[model samples]
Target: MATSTEHLIDIDRYTGELIQGWERIKQSIFVILTTRLRTRLMRLWWGSKFNEMQDKPGNEEVLMSSMMAAISAINTYEPEFKVTRVVIEDMGPDGEITITVEGIDLVDEALRRLKTTI
Candidate 1:
Protein backbone atom coordinates (compact mmCIF):
# COMPACT_ATOMS: atom_id res chain seq x y z
CA MET A 1 0.00 0.00 0.00
CA ALA A 2 2.95 2.28 0.02
CA THR A 3 2.66 4.84 -2.72
CA SER A 4 6.10 6.24 -2.84
CA THR A 5 7.25 8.15 -5.90
CA GLU A 6 10.51 6.26 -5.92
CA HIS A 7 8.89 2.95 -6.92
CA LEU A 8 9.79 1.25 -10.16
CA ILE A 9 8.17 2.43 -13.34
CA ASP A 10 6.01 0.05 -15.32
CA ILE A 11 7.95 -0.83 -18.45
CA ASP A 12 5.01 -2.36 -20.27
CA ARG A 13 3.15 0.89 -20.20
CA TYR A 14 3.79 4.19 -21.91
CA THR A 15 3.01 6.33 -18.91
CA GLY A 16 6.41 5.69 -17.37
CA GLU A 17 5.14 6.62 -13.94
CA LEU A 18 6.36 5.02 -10.75
CA ILE A 19 4.34 2.01 -9.59
CA GLN A 20 3.02 1.32 -6.11
CA GLY A 21 4.87 -0.71 -3.49
CA TRP A 22 3.96 -4.37 -4.01
CA GLU A 23 2.91 -3.74 -7.60
CA ARG A 24 6.24 -2.09 -8.22
CA ILE A 25 8.12 -5.13 -7.03
CA LYS A 26 5.76 -7.44 -8.87
CA GLN A 27 6.21 -5.65 -12.16
CA SER A 28 9.94 -5.55 -11.62
CA ILE A 29 10.08 -9.31 -11.22
CA PHE A 30 7.86 -9.76 -14.22
CA VAL A 31 10.17 -7.57 -16.27
CA ILE A 32 13.15 -9.51 -15.06
CA LEU A 33 11.54 -12.84 -15.85
CA THR A 34 10.47 -11.85 -19.33
CA THR A 35 13.63 -10.09 -20.40
CA ARG A 36 16.01 -12.03 -22.60
CA LEU A 37 19.57 -12.28 -21.41
CA ARG A 38 22.11 -10.23 -23.34
CA THR A 39 19.34 -8.17 -24.83
CA ARG A 40 20.00 -5.23 -22.58
CA LEU A 41 22.74 -2.92 -23.65
CA MET A 42 25.81 -2.81 -21.39
CA ARG A 43 24.20 -5.41 -19.10
CA LEU A 44 24.86 -8.59 -20.98
CA TRP A 45 24.31 -10.69 -17.88
CA TRP A 46 20.99 -9.19 -16.95
CA GLY A 47 17.71 -11.13 -17.46
CA SER A 48 16.03 -14.43 -16.60
CA LYS A 49 17.15 -16.18 -19.80
CA PHE A 50 13.86 -18.06 -19.90
CA ASN A 51 14.17 -18.18 -23.67
CA GLU A 52 16.65 -21.01 -23.26
CA MET A 53 13.95 -23.18 -21.74
CA GLN A 54 11.91 -23.25 -24.90
CA ASP A 55 11.92 -26.27 -27.27
CA LYS A 56 13.04 -28.48 -24.38
CA PRO A 57 11.19 -31.04 -22.28
CA GLY A 58 9.46 -29.38 -19.39
CA ASN A 59 10.60 -31.57 -16.54
CA GLU A 60 10.99 -30.82 -12.86
CA GLU A 61 14.75 -30.63 -13.12
CA VAL A 62 14.76 -28.29 -16.08
CA LEU A 63 12.13 -26.08 -14.50
CA MET A 64 13.94 -25.95 -11.21
CA SER A 65 17.23 -25.21 -12.84
CA SER A 66 15.80 -22.40 -14.92
CA MET A 67 14.03 -20.94 -11.91
CA MET A 68 17.09 -21.09 -9.73
CA ALA A 69 19.26 -19.45 -12.36
CA ALA A 70 16.66 -16.79 -12.90
CA ILE A 71 16.28 -16.15 -9.20
CA SER A 72 19.99 -15.72 -8.81
CA ALA A 73 20.24 -13.51 -11.85
CA ILE A 74 17.30 -11.42 -10.75
CA ASN A 75 19.13 -10.47 -7.61
CA THR A 76 22.01 -9.19 -9.67
CA TYR A 77 19.93 -6.71 -11.60
CA GLU A 78 17.36 -5.89 -8.99
CA PRO A 79 19.14 -5.70 -5.68
CA GLU A 80 16.08 -4.13 -4.12
CA PHE A 81 14.47 -7.55 -3.95
CA LYS A 82 15.94 -10.39 -1.97
CA VAL A 83 14.00 -13.36 -3.27
CA THR A 84 13.49 -16.09 -0.67
CA ARG A 85 11.19 -18.41 -2.62
CA VAL A 86 10.18 -18.96 -6.22
CA VAL A 87 7.43 -21.28 -7.46
CA ILE A 88 7.11 -21.91 -11.17
CA GLU A 89 3.89 -23.50 -12.36
CA ASP A 90 3.92 -24.96 -15.85
CA MET A 91 0.29 -24.71 -16.82
CA GLY A 92 0.67 -26.68 -20.00
CA PRO A 93 -3.02 -27.30 -20.29
CA ASP A 94 -3.62 -23.57 -20.18
CA GLY A 95 -0.60 -22.77 -22.32
CA GLU A 96 0.69 -20.46 -19.64
CA ILE A 97 3.58 -20.21 -17.21
CA THR A 98 3.11 -18.71 -13.80
CA ILE A 99 5.77 -17.64 -11.33
CA THR A 100 5.22 -16.87 -7.67
CA VAL A 101 7.90 -15.09 -5.72
CA GLU A 102 8.23 -14.27 -2.02
CA GLY A 103 10.87 -11.77 -1.05
CA ILE A 104 11.80 -8.78 1.05
CA ASP A 105 11.96 -5.24 -0.24
CA LEU A 106 15.41 -4.09 0.71
CA VAL A 107 14.35 -0.47 0.41
CA ASP A 108 11.44 -0.75 2.83
CA GLU A 109 12.28 -3.95 4.72
CA ALA A 110 8.82 -5.35 4.02
CA LEU A 111 7.81 -8.84 2.96
CA ARG A 112 6.10 -9.11 -0.45
CA ARG A 113 4.54 -11.90 -2.42
CA LEU A 114 3.89 -11.54 -6.13
CA LYS A 115 2.60 -13.82 -8.87
CA THR A 116 2.91 -13.27 -12.61
CA THR A 117 2.08 -15.24 -15.75
CA ILE A 118 4.59 -15.48 -18.55
Candidate 2:
Protein backbone atom coordinates (compact mmCIF):
# COMPACT_ATOMS: atom_id res chain seq x y z
CA MET A 1 0.00 0.00 0.00
CA ALA A 2 1.10 3.52 -0.65
CA THR A 3 2.14 5.47 2.40
CA SER A 4 2.69 9.11 3.31
CA THR A 5 2.22 11.95 0.87
CA GLU A 6 3.15 9.82 -2.10
CA HIS A 7 0.03 7.72 -1.57
CA LEU A 8 -2.41 10.60 -1.79
CA ILE A 9 -3.75 9.94 1.66
CA ASP A 10 -5.57 12.86 3.20
CA ILE A 11 -3.37 14.16 5.96
CA ASP A 12 -5.69 16.86 7.11
CA ARG A 13 -8.76 16.13 9.31
CA TYR A 14 -7.48 12.69 10.28
CA THR A 15 -10.00 10.92 8.08
CA GLY A 16 -7.84 7.83 7.61
CA GLU A 17 -9.21 7.71 4.10
CA LEU A 18 -7.07 7.22 1.07
CA ILE A 19 -7.87 9.13 -2.06
CA GLN A 20 -8.02 6.51 -4.80
CA GLY A 21 -6.87 6.41 -8.40
CA TRP A 22 -7.24 9.63 -10.33
CA GLU A 23 -8.62 11.55 -7.38
CA ARG A 24 -5.53 10.74 -5.40
CA ILE A 25 -3.33 11.97 -8.18
CA LYS A 26 -5.42 15.10 -8.52
CA GLN A 27 -5.09 15.91 -4.84
CA SER A 28 -1.37 15.43 -5.05
CA ILE A 29 -1.17 17.92 -7.83
CA PHE A 30 -3.30 20.32 -5.84
CA VAL A 31 -1.00 20.13 -2.86
CA ILE A 32 2.02 20.72 -5.03
CA LEU A 33 0.34 23.70 -6.60
CA THR A 34 -0.70 25.16 -3.29
CA THR A 35 2.53 24.67 -1.38
CA ARG A 36 4.53 27.88 -1.13
CA LEU A 37 8.03 27.76 -2.54
CA ARG A 38 10.85 27.33 -0.01
CA THR A 39 8.44 26.48 2.79
CA ARG A 40 8.49 22.70 2.99
CA LEU A 41 10.63 21.18 5.68
CA MET A 42 11.84 18.30 3.50
CA ARG A 43 14.25 20.46 1.53
CA LEU A 44 15.90 21.50 4.75
CA TRP A 45 13.20 24.17 4.67
CA TRP A 46 14.78 25.43 1.47
CA GLY A 47 12.90 23.82 -1.36
CA SER A 48 12.38 25.67 -4.61
CA LYS A 49 8.65 26.07 -4.84
CA PHE A 50 5.90 27.56 -6.99
CA ASN A 51 3.81 30.51 -5.90
CA GLU A 52 0.15 29.67 -5.25
CA MET A 53 -1.13 32.82 -6.98
CA GLN A 54 -3.32 33.51 -3.99
CA ASP A 55 -2.07 37.02 -3.50
CA LYS A 56 -4.79 39.45 -4.46
CA PRO A 57 -3.88 40.72 -7.90
CA GLY A 58 -4.70 44.06 -9.37
CA ASN A 59 -6.14 42.39 -12.46
CA GLU A 60 -7.58 39.09 -13.61
CA GLU A 61 -5.08 38.70 -16.41
CA VAL A 62 -2.20 38.87 -13.98
CA LEU A 63 -3.65 36.15 -11.77
CA MET A 64 -4.46 33.88 -14.71
CA SER A 65 -1.04 34.20 -16.21
CA SER A 66 0.72 33.41 -12.93
CA MET A 67 -1.43 30.39 -12.20
CA MET A 68 -1.08 29.01 -15.71
CA ALA A 69 2.67 29.15 -15.70
CA ALA A 70 3.01 27.58 -12.26
CA ILE A 71 0.45 24.85 -12.83
CA SER A 72 1.83 23.90 -16.22
CA ALA A 73 5.33 23.66 -14.86
CA ILE A 74 4.11 20.84 -12.59
CA ASN A 75 3.73 18.54 -15.60
CA THR A 76 7.45 18.05 -15.80
CA TYR A 77 8.62 14.48 -15.06
CA GLU A 78 5.75 13.50 -12.80
CA PRO A 79 4.20 10.18 -13.81
CA GLU A 80 0.95 10.69 -11.91
CA PHE A 81 -0.59 13.09 -14.38
CA LYS A 82 -0.32 14.57 -17.85
CA VAL A 83 -2.02 17.93 -17.38
CA THR A 84 -3.91 18.96 -20.50
CA ARG A 85 -5.25 22.27 -19.29
CA VAL A 86 -5.81 24.48 -16.28
CA VAL A 87 -8.63 27.01 -15.93
CA ILE A 88 -8.77 29.37 -13.01
CA GLU A 89 -11.94 31.35 -12.43
CA ASP A 90 -12.45 34.02 -9.86
CA MET A 91 -15.85 33.54 -8.29
CA GLY A 92 -17.27 36.96 -7.68
CA PRO A 93 -19.06 38.12 -4.53
CA ASP A 94 -17.91 35.15 -2.48
CA GLY A 95 -14.33 35.99 -3.34
CA GLU A 96 -13.21 32.47 -3.99
CA ILE A 97 -10.93 31.09 -6.68
CA THR A 98 -12.03 28.07 -8.62
CA ILE A 99 -9.41 25.94 -10.25
CA THR A 100 -10.34 23.49 -12.95
CA VAL A 101 -7.68 20.98 -13.83
CA GLU A 102 -7.94 18.75 -16.85
CA GLY A 103 -5.49 15.89 -17.12
CA ILE A 104 -4.91 12.25 -17.96
CA ASP A 105 -3.76 9.73 -15.39
CA LEU A 106 -0.52 8.24 -16.56
CA VAL A 107 -1.03 4.99 -14.65
CA ASP A 108 -4.47 4.04 -16.02
CA GLU A 109 -4.78 6.45 -18.93
CA ALA A 110 -8.02 7.91 -17.65
CA LEU A 111 -9.15 11.46 -18.29
CA ARG A 112 -10.01 13.56 -15.22
CA ARG A 113 -11.58 16.90 -14.48
CA LEU A 114 -10.82 18.17 -11.02
CA LYS A 115 -12.28 21.32 -9.53
CA THR A 116 -10.82 22.93 -6.45
CA THR A 117 -11.87 26.09 -4.63
CA ILE A 118 -9.58 28.26 -2.58
Candidate 3:
Protein backbone atom coordinates (compact mmCIF):
# COMPACT_ATOMS: atom_id res chain seq x y z
CA MET A 1 0.00 0.00 0.00
CA ALA A 2 1.13 3.48 -0.82
CA THR A 3 1.38 6.13 1.84
CA SER A 4 -0.51 9.42 2.03
CA THR A 5 0.51 12.37 4.12
CA GLU A 6 -2.03 14.93 2.95
CA HIS A 7 -4.06 16.74 5.54
CA LEU A 8 -7.79 16.28 5.71
CA ILE A 9 -10.00 19.23 4.88
CA ASP A 10 -11.51 18.94 8.33
CA ILE A 11 -9.74 17.84 11.44
CA ASP A 12 -10.49 14.39 12.82
CA ARG A 13 -13.42 14.53 15.27
CA TYR A 14 -12.05 12.40 18.08
CA THR A 15 -8.35 12.77 17.54
CA GLY A 16 -8.42 16.42 16.48
CA GLU A 17 -5.78 15.58 13.89
CA LEU A 18 -5.52 15.43 10.14
CA ILE A 19 -6.68 12.39 8.23
CA GLN A 20 -4.96 10.74 5.35
CA GLY A 21 -5.11 7.74 3.01
CA TRP A 22 -8.55 6.24 2.44
CA GLU A 23 -10.35 8.79 4.53
CA ARG A 24 -8.84 11.56 2.47
CA ILE A 25 -9.94 9.78 -0.68
CA LYS A 26 -13.50 9.59 0.68
CA GLN A 27 -13.46 13.28 1.43
CA SER A 28 -12.26 14.01 -2.07
CA ILE A 29 -15.04 11.95 -3.55
CA PHE A 30 -17.63 13.79 -1.49
CA VAL A 31 -16.35 17.15 -2.65
CA ILE A 32 -16.32 16.11 -6.29
CA LEU A 33 -19.85 14.75 -6.16
CA THR A 34 -21.38 17.80 -4.50
CA THR A 35 -19.54 20.61 -6.29
CA ARG A 36 -21.19 21.97 -9.42
CA LEU A 37 -19.11 22.05 -12.56
CA ARG A 38 -17.70 25.41 -13.62
CA THR A 39 -18.58 26.96 -10.25
CA ARG A 40 -15.00 27.00 -9.08
CA LEU A 41 -13.26 29.74 -11.03
CA MET A 42 -9.75 28.36 -10.86
CA ARG A 43 -10.72 24.73 -11.19
CA LEU A 44 -13.49 25.18 -13.73
CA TRP A 45 -13.31 21.57 -14.82
CA TRP A 46 -12.82 20.13 -11.39
CA GLY A 47 -16.39 19.06 -10.53
CA SER A 48 -19.15 16.77 -11.73
CA LYS A 49 -22.31 17.93 -13.50
CA PHE A 50 -24.33 15.33 -11.61
CA ASN A 51 -25.93 18.03 -9.49
CA GLU A 52 -27.58 19.36 -12.64
CA MET A 53 -29.84 16.33 -12.62
CA GLN A 54 -31.45 17.70 -9.50
CA ASP A 55 -35.16 18.58 -9.75
CA LYS A 56 -35.29 16.90 -13.14
CA PRO A 57 -37.12 13.70 -13.88
CA GLY A 58 -35.18 10.74 -12.53
CA ASN A 59 -35.61 8.58 -15.55
CA GLU A 60 -33.04 6.03 -16.70
CA GLU A 61 -31.60 8.43 -19.23
CA VAL A 62 -31.04 11.16 -16.67
CA LEU A 63 -29.57 8.75 -14.18
CA MET A 64 -27.25 7.30 -16.77
CA SER A 65 -26.15 10.74 -17.83
CA SER A 66 -25.49 11.70 -14.24
CA MET A 67 -23.49 8.55 -13.71
CA MET A 68 -21.36 9.22 -16.75
CA ALA A 69 -20.80 12.81 -15.72
CA ALA A 70 -19.71 11.70 -12.28
CA ILE A 71 -17.27 9.11 -13.60
CA SER A 72 -15.87 11.56 -16.07
CA ALA A 73 -15.39 14.25 -13.47
CA ILE A 74 -13.60 11.95 -11.06
CA ASN A 75 -11.44 10.54 -13.82
CA THR A 76 -10.53 13.98 -14.99
CA TYR A 77 -9.90 15.67 -11.68
CA GLU A 78 -8.72 13.02 -9.24
CA PRO A 79 -6.30 10.43 -10.54
CA GLU A 80 -5.74 8.57 -7.33
CA PHE A 81 -9.25 7.10 -7.34
CA LYS A 82 -10.19 4.68 -10.11
CA VAL A 83 -13.96 4.41 -10.36
CA THR A 84 -15.35 0.91 -10.88
CA ARG A 85 -19.05 1.74 -10.68
CA VAL A 86 -21.52 4.46 -9.73
CA VAL A 87 -25.06 3.78 -8.61
CA ILE A 88 -27.71 6.45 -8.25
CA GLU A 89 -30.99 5.83 -6.46
CA ASP A 90 -33.85 8.26 -6.88
CA MET A 91 -35.92 8.81 -3.76
CA GLY A 92 -39.44 9.37 -5.03
CA PRO A 93 -41.35 12.52 -4.05
CA ASP A 94 -38.72 13.53 -1.55
CA GLY A 95 -36.40 15.41 -3.90
CA GLU A 96 -33.51 13.55 -2.37
CA ILE A 97 -31.05 11.37 -4.23
CA THR A 98 -28.45 8.92 -3.02
CA ILE A 99 -25.27 8.30 -4.93
CA THR A 100 -22.94 5.41 -4.25
CA VAL A 101 -19.47 5.37 -5.74
CA GLU A 102 -17.32 2.27 -5.79
CA GLY A 103 -13.73 2.47 -6.82
CA ILE A 104 -10.17 1.35 -6.27
CA ASP A 105 -7.73 3.39 -4.32
CA LEU A 106 -4.69 3.81 -6.50
CA VAL A 107 -2.58 4.76 -3.51
CA ASP A 108 -3.33 1.56 -1.63
CA GLU A 109 -4.83 -0.77 -4.24
CA ALA A 110 -7.91 -1.39 -2.13
CA LEU A 111 -11.59 -1.16 -3.00
CA ARG A 112 -13.34 1.89 -1.57
CA ARG A 113 -16.93 3.01 -1.49
CA LEU A 114 -18.54 6.38 -0.85
CA LYS A 115 -22.22 7.07 -0.43
CA THR A 116 -23.77 10.51 -0.23
CA THR A 117 -27.20 12.11 -0.37
CA ILE A 118 -27.86 15.18 -2.45
Is candidate 2 or 3 superior in lDDT? 3
Backbone clash pairs for candidate 1 read none
| lDDT at residue 81 of model 3 (Cα atoms) | 81
Write the residue-wise lDDT of candidate 2 on 27-89 in tens digits: 566666666666766753431133444555637776666566545555752457777887775
Clash totals, every prediction? 0, 1, 0
Model 2 Cα shift for residue 58 (angstroms): 5.8
CA lDDT, candidate 3, residue 55: 79
Off by over 4 Å in 1: 1-14, 93-95
- Per-prediction TM-score: 0.76, 0.67, 0.80
TM-score, structure 3 vs. true: 0.80
lDDT of each: 0.71, 0.60, 0.78
Worst 10 residues of 2 by lDDT: 1-10
Candidate 1 per-residue lDDT over residues 50-98, each given as its tens digit: 6566555778877877788767866777757888888876645444677
- TM-score-superior candidate, 2 or 3: 3
For candidate 3, the lDDT comes to 0.78
Model 3, span 3-47: residue lDDT tens: 464433455546788877777677777788789978999988678
Question: Best to worst by TM-score, what's the order?
Answer: 3, 1, 2
User: What does the lDDT read for residue 95 in candidate 1?
Assistant: 42
| lDDT at 87, model 3 | 93
Model 2, position 108, has a per-residue lDDT of: 64
